[model samples]
Target: MSSRISTTRVHEAGIETLQKRQVELAGAQERLTSGKRVAKASDDPAAAARAERALAGEMRAQTSERAVEASRTAMSLSETAMGDVVELLQQAREAMVAAGNASYTDNERRGLAEKLTSIRQQLLSVANRTDGAGSFLFGGQGAGSAPFVDAAGGVQYRGIAGERRTEPATDLPLTINGDGVFMTSLTGNGVFQTSAAAGVTQAWIDNGQVSDPSALTGSTYTLQFSIAAGATTYAVLENGLPTAVTAAPYVSGRDITVDGQTFRISGAPASGDQFTVQPSTATLSVFDTLDRAIGQLGTPSRTAAQIAQGNTDALRDLDQSMSQLQGARAAAGEMLVRIDSETGRLADQKLANQSERSRAEDLDMTDAISKFQNLQTGYDAALKSYSMVQRLSLFQYLNT
Candidate 1:
């Protein structure tokens, strides 16, 4: 009577296994259908984290790409503008050479002057160039205004201070500065100052009753000097290589009462030997050695001595201008080459970033699909087994 039968707990533990399989199958199917591995953090926490990092990296790569692109644009503009300047300078040099030849007639010179004026205007245009795309090639960051403007016939830069960043890449960290620093007259002192060149030669010139023309006398040719408006002191090759004259310690302006005659020097006097007051000294618009050459090229029907003076000084100033222009051109060419090299490096970096991002976040379709099919098979088996076990009641047992 106390006989006991071995009884099973009627447990559906297989259901649990089935449920887990179902979850896996659903996830795999989702990945296969949508072509996405980590749609949400709940799907796979580890994958979610990895995806986030990849996404952030991609965004950063894009930012770097944009930055490099901007730098490229700036370099292109800078190169073009500089090229124009070079061509203009070359034309100017040619005109100057023609001026050097004695055969250049007045009519020919007038034509050359017109050509020179056009070139000068073109040069000014080049200097005042702008990207006009909310930036300036010659200017740096924080640009609030145009990079360059004309101030009293000279160029003035009013843009923000910035440095052109080197192409952002994994290679060498280099930079390009487009501040027009090389030949920029305002930034530093070259041979002379940019202010109008007019000064009094207080040193003694020995000539006539004043002193012997070729004597080392301490007597400075004391003459009152005052420069008229729109005039500059181009040449001051004093009798001897006297020291620089300043008006600070002594009276700077020409207001000294020399003897009884108050002879005022409007501009710097040529020499005591040849003294005749003229209205204009030389160039009124420009005040450099080039401008001096223009003054010397005039075939004036005036005095023979005046014509000789013009011819003599013109050639000397042209030589000086050539040296200045050549130096500036060389510097610009060097900078352009640097920018081009930097650009290549930046492009390489962008490509590398793309590869890295793809590796971290891309899905593998073949592997995902195979895993999904296996999970589906396991779930089907569990469901069928659960149904079969449930139907094994006493009624069904009797029939069996």
Candidate 2:
């Protein structure tokens, strides 16, 4: 097949070869400049798709990081506020203890009451603390304004009763429940409450404890004392029904066990004096506890027995409020710990996403530069060959 090649065909073929080489060189230069293996979907469809997915994952990780930051700020503020609340409650407890000193005059007790009132106001402020962005730390889910407000009855929580969380893959709390922190504490000893009858100044009852959890019936119990025939005796009544311990010898400051509860009643009691014990199911407000203690301390006409009873009850209630506040603070601390854990996890996830994106689309600089140089050399050689072929003529070739 010895066919002579035409100049027109040769010129067209040489031009096409140069154009193809230039295009390849340009593509290599573009890749090197952009530092990306797949600049567009046309370059590598599968690699581009993988890079897109990785980029989306990176964005999500960034969003989660932002959420975690917001949650951390809010929870840190809340935890600090809870700590302040605990400190204020402890101060109130100290004031209550000072008020219990029998040597303190009525005026001295009133001064302690004033101190407690101040602490109460401080506690309310802590409960309504903000995140510096017009949001409350203990606002629960949400609130239009302040969460806790001082009303005529006492301090009340107006916020929702649950926590608010950040919006991201890692859900984190932004607020704590004001109601749980400040309103919903158990009364008395957390099991049962004991109280002397009104006008029974001769005797006082101590806060009772549970002796046997299985024997508890949650029934109301009444202890009636009788001074008959020069002997002191007491009778136990369970929900107004007489028990087998009728006319038991009355001993002052002796432990009296009924059902599953145990308590002590000190001082002499006249005939028909009564004390009641009931289950501690009632909710006690921290503010109400402080108010009662203040009122008791401010009263100057209370007998010794009455004062002792008031002190006992006030201390018990204060301890309960402190317990509740401590629990809430502990919860806030735990939330902060969780936030830290989530932060570390999100950081690792973000790093992984970045690595995946780099693997999918990022160019290897060393390999890319070498390939670009090779492409440049090939394009230059093609240009030189085209020039030499263009100079070739039929007469010059025949003379040679």
| Candidate with the greatest lDDT versus the true structure | 2
Q: Model 1: per-residue lDDT, tens digit, 62-159?
A: 66656655655655666667666656656766776675456666767667767776776676666556666755555655455655565664545565
Q: Total clashes, candidate 1?
A: 15
lDDT of 1 at 216: 28
- Per-candidate TM vs. native? 0.59, 0.94
lDDT of 2 by residue, 1-400 (tens): 7999898888888999999999998988888889899999998899999999999998998998898999989878877887887888888878877777778898998899889888888888878889899989888899989988888988778899998888847878888888887888888799998999987887899998999999999999999999999899999999999999899999999999988899999999889999999998648888888888888888887888988999899889889888888888888789889989998998999899899989999999999999889988988998998898898898989989
- RMSD in Å for candidate 1, one decimal? 11.2
Poorest 10 consecutive residues of model 2 by lDDT?
A: 93-102
RMSD of each: 11.2, 1.9
